[model samples]
Target: MPETPEIPDIPAQIPALREDPETEGTQDAAGTVSGEDGDRGTAEPEAEHGDAGFDLGEPGFDHSAPVVAESLVPESVRQVAARATLPFQAARADLSFGTAFWYNDLIETGGDHEVIRQYLVTATSRTLFEIGQWTLRGDLTDPEQPVDELVMGGFAKRWKVLEGLGVAVMPTVELHLHAERKGWRWDTQEITDGLAAQADDIAAIGAEPMPAYILGHEADDSGRSAHPDRTQRLLAGEVCRPAPDAPLTWSDPLPTGFDGAPVFAALPLPDEQLKLLCLGVALPGEGGPDAPATVVAFADLRPAIHALAPHRRRHWWQRG
Candidate 1:
């Protein structure tokens, strides 16, 4: 492995900045909030109380905790699902999208979400890309913590499949620290300085219980509104074996707004065991014959993920 470069160092201290009063975390059940950022110069409607990939609105659940044994299915995936599988929302041009913390960063692919995906792939690295236009929006957080996990900033990155078929373009963001440090308030320069940093193929599994599961909130329309929070989700198993160049696919349709959903090939192993290959991000899809979803193949992403220095959930970071 090559030596990783040292970017800017972010201290654990929060600036004298106070969070936006209006964006404060909601009461108990609707735990959500957004940190104030500069105007990214885009006319897109801003996320009132952003999602920031929260823990599926379950009050007592801990995202950092390990996945528990199966629970009975309910209204939505929120009940039967593990906290890690749940994702928040993001959008640009008033276009809605879903993104989650896979490994460490807030990832959303451009393949299905052309607008923001294109912006993310083309956006400059180590700099603020629309620090304000708003990247996430959904009802948000647990009472134990102040703010939910947030993508403080985002940048463009590309990864070539091990087979060399094509490249995967992604707009990945840095999740702000969830601890009670700062209430999610940081200027563009502050975020950029922190970003100073900064897929594919398949799972070689030996057959575990459920190889993988797709979890995300698909909107009722392009408006990306899941009004009540609990909505339908796209669920399926992984293509245990896929062609080197082929994008990962599943039997179930990859519903619209499924971008950036994480897939963990449960070789019944740990998330870090194969940070190189077992991890994958879903390609956004529109119901019918949805494009072949992705395996994101983190082979190359691991390096970039570390280079950029995105925040990792305390449990995943400490253990996985």
Candidate 2:
């Protein structure tokens, strides 16, 4: 928020000077290609082939053009191929062929990929954060698009960032695999019902249904409690308790399905502001100085989320 400044205008055109003589091509210090000598047109007859085209050259090869393997490839392609052979970072950003359109347009020609990656990550993060901040402020262009809706929107944008980093969404599968690997099992029914309840609340807020699931650990040899104390813990309709300080406290004497699985459920928050509250004994994995312990804590909506309803008008760029 401190860095909020006027958005800079992005130039649609490349900065490089045009090679077309009819355009902006300039004659310098005696009118030669490299400023050497000779008839500029025939200084080196073969070099004319190079200077005869646009500085950036044509956009990729036209398949309709006649092809001899030698002629099949355009001069730009040959130059790009030579450059790509240097190293990935040294590759040209404006190869025209096989280049990512956004990368080609947004990134400068011959830009380093490592730099480009960092640029992309930063740009995308800033863009999403601004959108989130604006959405929370309810200053968005469309006032009818409620502030609460931004949570789902933010989630979607964040998911795109995760995907770009090659992260897969494996809520259920990840929990099962991790539990099995750590010698534990997931209480799916308990988790699913909790999420289903949250989904209903979110739907009531005019948000699309977002079914949630608990991705957590099972008991293991690391500690006796790491595993289920009894098979009944894995089943549904079992007693559900809350951490002493948690809000919206409730207990379910009966649960659904399995008996031995340690579980947690996603429960809805009040006032149509749906969120996951811890319902069962199992808690999320925590990183710690020593071995992390699974301790129950109250689950509440993020403070930013709760701040949505009343403060949205602050983000409105212009007031009616």
- Best lDDT among the predictions, by candidate number: 1
- Model 1 Cα shift for residue 283 (angstroms): 1.1
What local lDDT score does residue 240 receive in model 1, on the 0 to 100 scale?
40
- Candidate 1 lDDT (Cα, 0 to 1): 0.32
**1-320: candidate 1 lDDT, tens digit per residue:** 32211221222122233243222222222232233321111221111112232222332121112233333222223432333333333323433435443232222222222011111211111122332112322222222333233333222212212223122322222222222223442221111111111121233432222345665555545454433243436465654434444445543555654555544433322543321112455553334344545444455444444344333223445463
Worst 10 residues of 2 by lDDT: 95-104
lDDT of 2 by residue, 1-320 (tens): 32211111112111222233221112322211111111111111011112323233222111011122322223322322211110001012221100000111111123211000000111121222211211111221122222221111221132122222111110111112222223332221111122212322322322222222222211222332311221111222222223333222112221211111122333333443323322222221233212212212112221111222122222356455
Each model's C-alpha lDDT?
0.32, 0.20
- Per-residue lDDT, model 2, residue 21, is 20
Query: Candidate 2's error at 314, in angstroms?
Result: 5.2
Q: What TM-score against the true fold does each predicted structure earn? A: 0.43, 0.18
Candidate 1 residue spans exceeding 4 A from truth: 1-81, 85-93, 105-211, 222-234, 244-247, 268-278, 285-289, 309-320
